[model samples]
Structures are given as structure tokens and as C-alpha cells.
Target: MSLPALSPYHLSLALTLPGLLLLWRNLRFRFYASRRARKIPHAQERVLILGASSGVGRSVAHVYVKRGAKVCIVGRRRDKLDDVARECRAMARGGAQVLMVKADCADPEEMVSLRERLEEEWQGLDTVIITAGVSALRPMMSNAGVEMDPRHPPKSQATAEGLTHAISVSNAAITGNFTGPLVSALSLIPLLTLTSRSPSILLLSSAAAVIPAPTRALYAATKAASLLLYQALAIEHPQIAFTFFLAGTIEGDFRASAVDKALPPNLTSSGSGSDSSEPTPLVREANPAKHGLKVGWVAQRCAQAVDRGEKNVFTPMYMRFGHLFYWIVPAYVEWRARVKYRYT
Candidate 1:
């Protein structure tokens, strides 16, 4: 479709298509998002979750299974992934059909293999949620294995993808979560229209992206870029409902300590949590809590939000600040984040 250029009237009309498309698409997914799950009670539809062995992904799997949805879990650890799969079967009412894909979500070749398997088995899924990420306790400088740090100065721990560790994770999600899954599923939109009620896509992004995590240099950058990527994609393809769940500083394995203790005097007793080895002023480390969810609490909250057809999804109540911070005062928000979390 070609159109004239430099015409005020034409330019004005050009702007109308996106807005109109968004409205129409939102209305469509309004009915389309949850229809299949709600419609097929006994024989629940399958939900494919990448990084489901732990964290929010596992919680989401259990949540859907409880409400009678079959779940497929994919993650790096076969044993851990299987454990989650077993748990899904235990909790699932209709008897969850849990499948495990034991491959790093960051590997393109493995992803290709997965795509083939999925194409054969399920073809298209009703819901796809991507919550895969990587973070390190110390900077490249601190690690002894590679001298990529200022003190040590060694090079080369790159992946076959020819990207850094952080980049590979982000690339896989972009390809698998946004590019592969979104395209593959939307490719079957015709099929979706015929079968399911509502087909929605949920993407998990960090509040750190908007806030700017200096320690997690590459990780934060890609996440920040991805947030915009989804926003633009949402505008482009409004017919498909896209929900970006901005999660907060979750209080679990992501937090580790001698013992779970109270927050500093400043934080509220209920909302705040503490840990000894997580991103502290001097160092950072990955604790299991990074994958921790209040399990059913957060999952059920998300399920209800999807049911109500809400656009923005946040886990804790405070994350509503993400909207105001990301949209209204991104610069200040980022500046403040840098002060609080980085270069200490």
C-alpha cells in the first residue's frame, strides 16, 4: 500500500490508522483473550512458559493449572524443570499435561528444535509468557575466571550466538518470546479465531529497565529497549492483546540471607523484605528469590487481570509507579535509580 507524501490531509489520515487499529484490536482481544480457557473447562488448553522452572514462570504455570490449564515448562535445568512439571500435575485439577524442554532459552539452534516440536504437537498456544533473564552479583571486573574486569582484564566467555552472556538471554527472548512466539502464534490467528475465546500474550519486564540498573549494564539496556519494543509492537498489532507485567523487587530467593529478616527502618513492615547476598551496595548475586512468586497470589492476580481485560499489569501495589516513572519522568526516574542502586 503506497500513499502520497507531503500532504497535510494525507499525513493526518495516516495517523488515524494506528489509533483506529488499536481500538479495534483491543475490542477484539477483549472477547478473544480468555475465551478458550474459560470455554474449555475439562480439557484445558496448553500454555507454553519459557523459564518456568522457577520464579514468576513457575507460579504462572501452577496458577493456570489450578484453574484447569495444561502447562509446558521450558528452562535450562532438566531436573528443576521436571520438578516444576511434577508440581503442576499435582496441583492441576483436570490433570495437567506438563511438558519440559530442557534447553537454554538463549540458544537459537535449540529454539529452532523447540519450534519444530511445538509445531508438531500444539501448533499454536492460547497464551505464551516469557520471563527469562540473567543477572550477576559482580561486574566483569570482579570475576576471577575471565579478566573482562578492570582489575583482571581477560577476554572471551562469549556464546555461539557471538554475543555476551546477557545479550544471549535477551536475544532469545526477543526471538522466542517476541519474534518467534508472537509471529508463530499470530501466524495462526485464523486458527485462533476458529477455536479459542481470547488469546493474549503476556511479557514480563523489569521495573529496573525504566529505573536503570547501572550494575546490570547490558541486562538493563536490553530490557529497557525491549519495553519500547513491546509498546511499539502493541500499537502495530492491537488485535492481539499484549499485557506487559512490570514486576517489582520481589521478596524471596532473589533475596538470600542468614535468615529472612525485617526491612530497614524506612520500608514498610508488610511491603519490604531483606537479604544479605542480593544486589547490595558493594556486590550483587542471584538468589533463588529472583524466581520466587507469592505463587498463587501473583498468578491469580494476573489471571483475574487478564479476565478483566486490563492493559497494564503490576505485581505489587507500588509498581503502579512504573507507569508514572516510565511515562512522565523517565529521566528523573532513571537518575534516581542510578543513585540508589549503582556505582556505590
Candidate 2:
């Protein structure tokens, strides 16, 4: 039924609204899919994790262990990695091998070493989940050392191998996490059994990435750059999915020591850190892997997303809307976040 001829503005709105609606619905469906998959059983596969000793990485290790996936734990903390491996062994169904390889994520050579080690044992790697990352929360304004510089920053840090930790992690997501993982899963593609032809590279970006935080310049820049790269990669490869998980304000141990000491009671309800009202010591949210996202929760949802072969995931729900807000009301968002977090 033809009603009336639409103006350019009307046509624009009409075209735009539906597209926005479709995107909203699609994201909503995936979110629900992730929620539902939480209820089902996890399918087992061999897994390797970086920064496997603590936080979300460790939690993911625990989740996979329960599912009978043999896990290889990698981190600088040999003892902690060993402990996690021992625990996984006790919980194994098929009795998974927990190879504790001590390598620094900041050092590319160390990472290369770890890869070589993997090659030595396994014919091929099934999955590699990298949760190894570090952050400095000293508002990035001052070169205040929130995190001490290790004499030798691991492969996760800027390694002697000429790769910055940011580059290794983000660029790795582009090549290995997204593209490489898909090709590796080719065997399962025929069955669409273990995982669909739809391979996925799930990355942990931040809410600060979308909405620029003053002190998080480098961290945000790196994450933003990687996020865009994923979009391009996804466009080029439709069959393989590129998933970026934009994690939001999760209170965890990784907050800068001084900031952690200043959080108010309401913010630090658990009595772990200080409140926002206090003077912020550091700026960029340290050891993002340490806190912010619930380790077990993220692990569970990650498994769910892996199982469903979903494309993208932005957690805490606010992030989906945030993508819109950051575009439309960026200044206000920045102002509020600064005031709210009380960045000096």
C-alpha cells in the first residue's frame, strides 16, 4: 500500500532505523544464545592458555578442565602455573596433560619458545586462548609506574624480539586468534561437530576503547586499532567469525595499587580497594586481566560463545548501547567517566 512519497530525511530515517533495529535484534539473539548455552554441557577440546595462573585466564582453565579438555598452562609464575595444572589433573575426565611452560608474553622469543615447545609434543594445536596482558592506570598523564617494569618484559610486554606486548596480543588476535584458529579447526569444519566452519577469535577489549579515556591513550589506542582490524578481517572472511568482547567496569584486583587503596566503601564493598571519591593514584586500570571481568563468568560465557559459533560479544549489556553512545555523545561520556573515576 503506497501512502505518500517520502522526503530525503524521512528516507534516511526509515533506512537507518531498520538497520539499527536489525543490529539490535541480532546482538540480542546472540546475547540470549550465550545465556542459554550456559545451561548446557561443554564439548571438550585441547586448549592452551596464556596468563593461565590467575584471573579470567585461570578461571577459563578451570572451566575447560571440568569439560575434560587437556590444558597447557603458560605464565611467568612457574609455581602458580604448576598449581593450576595440578588442580586440572585432579578434575580431568580423560586425564588431561597440564604442561607448564614458563614463558614471558612480553618477549617474542619466549613466546616462540612456547610455540616450539607445543610443536614438540602435539602434532597440531587445537586452540590457543591468550589472556595475558598488563595495564598502567596512572592516568597515562605522568609516566608513573603503576606496574614495575620487569628486567625482561615477557612476550606479552614489548619483547626483545621487537614486538610490543600490545602488538603481539592485538596483532595475534588478527592472525592467530582469528585467522589461524579457523584454519586449525578445518578438520572439525566437515563435521561442524567440535566447532562450526565458523571459527572465532574472542578478544578482550575495554569500554575505554570505544569511549576514549584521557589516561588510557596507549591502551585505548591499541585496543581500538585491534577492534577495527577485526572488523576488516571479519569482512574479508565471512565464514570465520571475529568476536571482540568489550568488557566494561569490572572491579578486580588489577586496579592500580594506589587507586585500589583509595576506593570508597560503595565501590569497594568487599573491602579490597578504595572508592572513586578518593584521589586516584594511577590511571589506566592495571593488570586488566587481574580484575574487572568475573573470571568464571567470562569463562562460562566464552565456552558458550565458542559452542554456538557466535560472531561478536560485548558484555555487561551496557557495551552494546555504549557503541552507540560513544559515537553520539562521546564528550559527555568522557567527561562523566573522568569525573566518575576521578582521574587526576
Candidate 3:
């Protein structure tokens, strides 16, 4: 069937409407950025960070310390926590207070004790950033030590051992990526709401939470769970600002600490260049230190997002489009993911 052609005015309106919307969005972002800059973290502000012993959490602690915020870093390793606390102190030039608490965020008892300590020491909390997460780099079936041929599928009972292994791996991922943040949030929300005029919580989530990828079955599922939990919290408590930092691959030893203990292929290669043709590098790459976003850069951006009370922030900004593209062409996205992770 032939349809009537649009008028020139209709064509002009179609093109102009998108440009106007883009212009409006740009202006709004700038407005909030400027407003947030004026209210950066102050010396008296108290920030409690979980999993601050290493990776993004450690870098974020340094960022807040430089801003003169009274920062408390919590982690399971006392030695690493001490190192982070010392580094934060050095970064602060002795101007900011750094508190180190050795506690597991996933442990409900530990979280409760940590919250009580913060209440007694700081009297309240202004900001809470949960960055503790474990990555899994094996495909769903491989995680269970199973390799199946579609044409000759094994009986369901034959996969019992593989299922057991998968469950164990899944548990670790859930504890680190989901339970930790859930416990910490439940313990600290009251303190945040009661103590600070501008209470903010930043969850260091990943693009995997929203965009499906190869070798991320458990990691993505767990992260998505926590991401939704905080999202629900945001709606339930409108007074406290919640920012979900949906970052892509970040330069660090994060993968080294994956629950699966299976690093991506070519883990040691030193390729630093990202493909300029792609909108964003949302795939696993070799030597994240060379190819991924700098840890410090991400931390600074995260702090800025918190200061701005941003709801969801995607690092490199272009990664935000990935969600739209995935929704439109999921198979294409999955194929690219398989290629990046070297699954095919």
C-alpha cells in the first residue's frame, strides 16, 4: 500500500523536534552540573564507603579525602583498609579525617556493628558509596564445567556436578555483588537520612546490569538485583539521593578478583587503543589498565555525580546509548559481546 507523502512542514518538524530535545537536555545537564559544583563535599561531611580496601572503592576514598570529607572506609581486610586509610590521609595532607573499619559488608552483624560505630563516632553519615562487587568471566554453562553440543544434549541428571559448581560460583557472586550492598543500605539509610541535609548514596554498578553480555550471567544478574534495590529505595525515600554509577570496563584489578577465578583471554596483552568506530567499549578487553577508563577519573566523576544528586550516570556518557541499542537489536549486541569476550 502506498502512503501519502509528508508535507515540507511535517518533515521540518520531525527533524527539528529531535534537535530541540537534544538542546534542552544539554542545557539541563549543564545547569545541574553548575549547581552541584557549588555544593561539593565539605570538611564536615561524613562519607562511609564499603569495599574501600581496593579498586574503585579505594580510588573513591581518595577522591573524597582530597575534598576534605571525613571519610570512613570499610572492608574485610584490615591490612588493606589500613593502607587505604593511610593513602587517604596522605591525599588529605592531614586536613581530612580517615577512619578504617574492618568489616564484611555482606555480614549482617558486621554491617550493624559498623553502623553503630559510625553513629557513635561521626554522629551521622552524609554519603554512602557501595563499590564492593565480584566479577564472573565464564559463560553460564562453562561456570558449571559443562560443555554441551546442541545436537547431542546430555541428560539433565548428568549435569548434577556441574550444577553444584555453578551454584557455588553463583553464591559468591551474589554475596559480593548483591548481599553486601543490600546489607549496607539497610544499615546506613537511617543514618544518612537523619544526619545530612543532602544525603546521597552512590552504587558503583556496571553497564552489565542493564546490557546483557557473554560471561556475565551471575555478575550481571546480581548487579541488576542490587541496582533495582537501590532504585526502589530511591522511590521509597525521596529525601536521600541515590546515584547508580553505571560504568563500563574500568582500569583496575577488579577482574583479577572475579569469583570464577577465570580471567578473560589475553589478560596480559598491552593494547590500550579503543576502537574509535564503536560508540563505547562495553566489552571485556585485555589489560584493563591500558584500555579501560582510569580509576581516578571514574572516582572523580562518581563524586561529581553524587554532588549533583544524579540518578543514573554512565561513564564516557556514550555508554548510555548502549541500553537503547540493545533494546532495538539485542542479537547484535550479544554477538558483539561474544566476539569481545572471545567466546566465538
Best by the lDDT measure: 3
Sorted by lDDT (best first), the order is 3, 1, 2
Residue-level lDDT of model 2, residues 233-298, one tens digit each, is 567756544456677765555343122122222221121122222333454334445646666788
Error of 3 at 39 (Å): 7.0
Clash pairs for candidate 3: none
Cand. 3 Cα-lDDT: 0.79
* Candidate order by decreasing TM-score: 3, 2, 1
Candidate 1: tens digits of C-alpha lDDT, residues 238-265 = 6656677777655444322111122223
lDDT of each: 0.57, 0.55, 0.79
Candidates 1 and 3 compared: the better one by TM-score is 3
Runs off by more than 4 Å, candidate 2? 1-44, 144-199, 233-240, 256-280, 283-293
Error of 2 at 260 (Å): 14
**Residue range 73-152, candidate 3, lDDT tens digits:** 98888888888888888879445889889999899998899888988988988889989878887656655554333234
Give the Å shift of residue 269 in candidate 3.
25
Q: After aligning candidate 2 to the native by TM-score, how far in Å is the CA of 93 from where it should be?
A: 2.6
